[model samples]
Target: MLLGGLLGGALDLLYAFGFAASRGVAPTRLLQTIASGLQGQAAYEGGTASAALGLFSHFAMSLAWAAGFALLASRVGWLRQRPAFAGPLYGIVVFLAMRCVVLPLSAYPHPVGFPPLSTSLDLLSHMFLFGLPIALLVARALRR
Candidate 1:
């Protein structure tokens, strides 16, 4: 679980950095800005403690998602048989569920500017960034 969480969080952060780089944004600065924005603060403090906490939080959330799928796969015969595909499928379903149900219900943070493009990029990022790593990990684990 620790390994999977670390791997997933690393993948997510790397993708986020790449995405920021593509937009000519410094990854660290972008993250700080986002963090400050979420906190409704004027400036970011750049605290290592906060950063570590954030990473752990992200990792735990990812691990929870993966574990949930593992539990479901254990019970569902079809999912157990198609372990390779199950992860990606679970990722897609989770993404859609979050977008359609969770996000809409929660007053959580979301992108503000670049409406359609931002949302599209977000969706694409989640699909590949989050989905791909989990998929690969699950596939590899099943094969072992």
Candidate 2:
């Protein structure tokens, strides 16, 4: 679970950071945005402290996702047998749950909207970078 979460979280953050950089957004600002999930708009004004909190929150969420997947995969044989297929699908699931359910229920200050280009990229990143690594790592570890 640790391995999967760490790898998946790191990859997810890297993709996010790269994407933000391409659009001229600083990593600190991105982190602050994440912190806003829990701290609301005040996170943006909290500077480095909020950014750190956001980073911690990101990893915590990743780990929770990893642990949940690991638990389910351990009991579900098909998941272990089909890492590549299951992983991407799981990523999609994660994305949907976060965007549709989680965010709506969280302390996020803004309403979530699906703005085509960014939404597509975000979905692809979750599938390929976040979910894929977690599923693959968990499958490998459990099979041993």
Best by TM-score: 2
Write one digit per residue (lDDT tens) for candidate 1, span 15-134. Answer: 777777988977555555434433433324655544444455456667877676656655676665665565556657766776677545543355334368656766665556665566
- Residue 51: error of model 2 in Å? 0.1
Tens-digit lDDT track for model 2 on 35-127?
A: 999999999999999999999999999999999889989999998789898888889999999999988898888889999988999999999
Candidate 2 lowest-lDDT run of ten? 102-111
Candidate 2: lDDT over CA atoms? 0.93
Query: RMSD of candidate 2 to the true fold?
Result: 0.8
Give me the candidate number with maximum lDDT.
2
| Cα misplacement distance, residue 73 of candidate 1 (Å) | 1.1
TM-score to true structure, per model: 0.65, 0.97
TM-score of candidate 2 versus the correct structure, residues matched by position: 0.97
**Candidate 1 residue 66 C-alpha distance from true site, Å:** 1.1
Candidate 1 residue 78 C-alpha distance from true site, Å = 2.3
Cα lDDT listed for each candidate: 0.59, 0.93
